[model samples]
Target: SYGMVIGYCRGDHFPNVLYGYVMLAVIGGLYGCIGGGFLGLGLETTESKQPKWAQLLTEMVAGGMLAWGLLIYQLEWFMTPPRSELWAACLGAAIAMIWYMVRNKFDRALRVAIYSMLGAGFGFSFGNFIQGLGQASGLSYNWWNVMEFILGLSGGIAMAYAVATTKWEKTMQPSRTVQNLSIIFIFLILPLVNYFSGFTEEKIRDLAENLSVSDIDSFVLFQHIEAWLSITLFAAIGIAAWWQRASDRLQKWFSFVMLSSLSLCYTLLALIHKGFFHIELSIKNSITLYLPILFLAVWLGTSITQPWLNSSNSAGNKKIWQLVAGMTICIILIALISIYINNPTDRTPQRF
Candidate 1:
């Protein structure tokens, strides 16, 4: 999950320093929290374990301290330095480590295969990012796009490992499927939370000056909706998964696959913006492709738990399949609906 946050926060990837954007905006039940008290989902106050005002003040101070600290640090340490070269070094180390660990599995012939895909992804993302920054005065740079390949490779492998670990190992029980789903989800959920962080509005505003939108109204609407639903879907899936507790393994695995798929989707997003879309935008370019996989693959897989059927009636695992399936479908539909409704998009959109 922490790794996911870093992925979404990659400043070079997405504009607006979306890093801090999520922190201040969305916390659970923010709609109910007022002055410093938690009113919970119902917005009905319960006993204040801590004084409301004190909590509010403390949260404020902490947030301020943290933000200022980061600001100082970036300005002093990272911001003062050249980002491209620095980021490149960092990314290179990561890519090396991933290949180091996994290289044995591949024959020499397969080396180029992994690197090629990674290179293409790297070039596309970095190229766009540099183009955006090219016009900025204080933020001028002459970094190579190939370095972004290292960044992307590092990012991809790190993301993969992050997913693999939580998805594969987080299962209290033995189930690869559940763990994988959970791992991937943690990635998606954090960014979703960040979308509500309130940082986006400013980030978008600042970037919009450099934006090339002949139709500002349309683009503005898209920016809002894309950010909004991105977060909502993450929350829906996360909460629903928790409520279902279908299987930690399934949760991790599904999320891992989803993020992996999103990485690919991101590439598609870049291509679309540059190609036919000609809108100078990158939306959930991968979502339509990913949605069906969720509906059919994980949702259906959870339904047909083989171990449960193979076991005796008294076996506890028997009901596990039923729970997984039922929850998968219920959660998917509910989440899908909730995400679309709360998103920038319209509910019952006449044509999706």
Candidate 2:
């Protein structure tokens, strides 16, 4: 979902400058497009016997263009000269209007765009409110953290809405028990993980005093452990569900929820690094931060594709499985390449 992508891109909470905005736009757009393309390829079967490469390429390009155009518009409006909350509100309303007009025809595209814009507007407002509260309470203010929190929360809400509204085919419907279990997992278990993993001042102080570790070291260790545990739990659930032949609805729900929650957690961790402590993003600081989420994404992709491989009801099903398998491999390879590019080997902390 576009909301998920926007939330992930806000993890660093880029500086309020033209260059920073540009980077945010590019990252958000690319992430959304790549993710959307993969999902489309994995879930939808094509009637035309066109080459897989051509079909995938077309889908990717279309997704990229749509996300990039909308994100550019969003960033430019948010970052241009004389930024105002009023302007942000107006911009969000305008996008909502467009969404309404296009909802009947371009339902998917409009949903992503409208949700993203709405989330941005709400995040900005909530950030300002938090900043004010901090000032009034004589506490240290971290506007970036507030912004990240709002974006993550809003994005999660939007993605949840999308999942609820989707019209799944008869073959894809999950049993009531599975659906109820998903709701409990998402609404209950997820919030508990996030709450306990949150690096609040008290938690950090306890970690430091109890473990005799430096602040930065404790922060890094906590983040790494949390990411690994959370992602592993999600991947395990997804794999088990697929192996048990859970319905398509369950798989889809888990995928969207994992994506949304991962994005939220990623940004929350980043906010702890950059906002609370003023640490900069560097190889040593951020390399491991995103790795677990990427792994989870790839693992989920494999799980989704594996089912198609098992279903041999027709020649069409066989072809679909092959195409999806290729896509899954490609996604994993790209994630691995990214890990290499980010260079996770550096041990020195970028900041204390």
Candidate 3:
């Protein structure tokens, strides 16, 4: 959303690339807020005590604010002027997570957070290097998408590995409310936010044309269905889940519903844009567009197969030092790659 907005405002790729640093920081903040909040919630659930909603909210807000603040400070100081400043946001988020973890004494979760942060940091830079190689190869594929996939894949694997390998205390299952709300945010709210942000008037018109849509009124109706209709379906599912709040598999059911609904939304949008009977080779190439859905399906399958692992109180000073060393190594590696990919024509670093 901000990318499109900045692109339109700046009217050039170079300036947009510069401003994109700020946007990346903002995105980092969002990720930190979501990630930290979810982790805190999970940790709290492990105890027999009820959910501490206010404390969780505070931690989330603090994580987001700190991440954004640190990145902005670095940008203002022109720190690493020629290189990407996204690492600052990652560091800020890690610090915030550790601070709250220390407050709660969630040693095991803290280690997981540190490991995940390091994985994401390294994954992003390494993904960028791979993207650069792809671009240099003159391949017609979407290298940017490949980078995103790598970043997510590596970060996810790191988190999962951390959870599985570490011994954990038995945690109370998260309540239906927590599970439902998390699913809503992940599947409904997040996508809607992204959709609305990029759904400008010009974009709508272009989409209509691209879909081979001829009638403007028809397109308007299509938009309404795409937006409100899906919301209605989601709301119905939400209400049903609430009514059956006692179900043990509410999270799994909600996950399946959310993914299915989102997939339906995308399929309907495409079908409405282009007639059902019509087909094109461009449609074949657009398979890359739905790769996220595939990824999400795999993640969902994994979660269902292996529920949240039991956590332990085993993160010691030695592990902390190791994680710190790992993060430092990631920084140096990213720096070397950034220098290697540096191009005069490309003002933006060729990295995630």
Candidate 4:
């Protein structure tokens, strides 16, 4: 509905549509607020009445659809110069769909958390970029860019808030007394692949379409190599993380989130500081990339939970299954995230 309305607003045929859509957004905001209050200032579910599989399907579908739709929309958005007017249309549709999903009844805490983490991720990302340019010697953020960053932050917060408070998905949180340190170790090891992927250069993409074909072969090669290296590393990390995630090790759940967050540190401190367009394919980056793998290997050697040894015992089957189910959820979530941005360009340092 909002998409149609946004489209109509910009059409030369309908000047009246703009005012009505703005009014609708205002009204929709109120609707969300009122419904959210009734649902909860905040509430935790005590009953295990909800069906886990159905909720998992809903979450998988919702997360997948949002990622796929946004990728298609944003790709055209970021790449196109002639259709700048339609960007708002994409934004409106995204917000409307999110509102519909969040307003549904489900588990409040889980929704809030999923939304919060996503928000934090984006906020942290934008903040990193903003600071990156601001701190650069020759770069400056005028009033326009500052305003843009503020708007980005606001939009991210709103989206996160919508996701977190809604009872949309109901999956059990891992709170067993066992500490799953391997999960964290694996997450930490994933991003080293990003910084390390500089070894191979393939003709993967053409980022500088404006340049004459022969003018910047060297620059293009550099960018392509960087991209390949980064993405290869990203893939390696995902596989390693999933392997540990599936292991029957006792690790704290939050540790996994923290480990995943190492990508942020790499992006902001190292990637950004190095500046854009300077990334290259090289042997050094490739060799250093194995550091995370080595660290994780050491940690796995001392991990407290022994999955393989216990698997032979029949009564320990439940614990193994719990680990299996937990890994299933994590891998599904990781797969959903991977669908969005596979061939990450130099434009963005990629992370989930």
The lDDT per prediction is: 0.35, 0.41, 0.54, 0.38
lDDT of 4 by residue, 1-352 (tens): 2223223222222222323223223323333333332233234333453324354445545654564456545653331223333333433443433444455443343333333323333332233333333433344334233423443443345444444323342444544432344444443444445434532223222433333335456665565455446545544555455546645562444344344444434443243223233445443443233345435633653353433221110113364356336534543333333333222234422111
lDDT of 2 by residue, 1-352 (tens): 2232222222221222213223233333333333332332223323431125464355445554554455455554333322222323333334333433343233343344333433343443344334334444565545444545554555444433333344422233447789668755754466457556665556656645654556756565765566455555654554454454456666556555545555554545554433323334554333334545456645654454322222221123354356436534543343333223232224311111
Per-model TM values vs. the true structure: 0.29, 0.34, 0.62, 0.33
Q: How far does residue 224 in candidate 2 sit from its true spot (Å)?
A: 7.2
lDDT of 4 at 36: 35
| TM-score, candidate number 1 | 0.29
Worst 10 residues of 3 by lDDT: 2-11
Q: What pairs collide in candidate 3?
A: 167-312, 168-310, 168-311, 168-312, 169-311
lDDT (tens digit, per residue) of candidate 3 on 1-352: 2223222112223343333333433333334333633564475456554345576456656765676575566446333444455544554555555676678766666656655655554455455556656665676777776767666766666666566656666778767789778767755686567556655567667776776766856676667566666555755665566556557878557546555656565555444343332335453343435645566755665556445555455655686578657655654554444444434353333222
For residues 1-352, write the lDDT of model 1, one tens digit per residue: 1222222222332222232113211210121112111211012122332124453345445554554454444544332122222322322333332233233321211222222223333333333334333323233333333234333443343222222222111212425677657655664654545444543555555545555556655655666665555455554555455455567676566554554444433333333222223333333333233334434544544454333222121112344355335534542343233332221222211110
List all candidate RMSDs to the true structure: 20.8, 18.2, 7.1, 17.1
Query: Number of the top candidate by lDDT?
Result: 3
lDDT of 4: 0.38
User: How many steric overlaps are in each model, in order?
Assistant: 30, 0, 5, 13
Order by TM-score, highest first: 3, 2, 4, 1
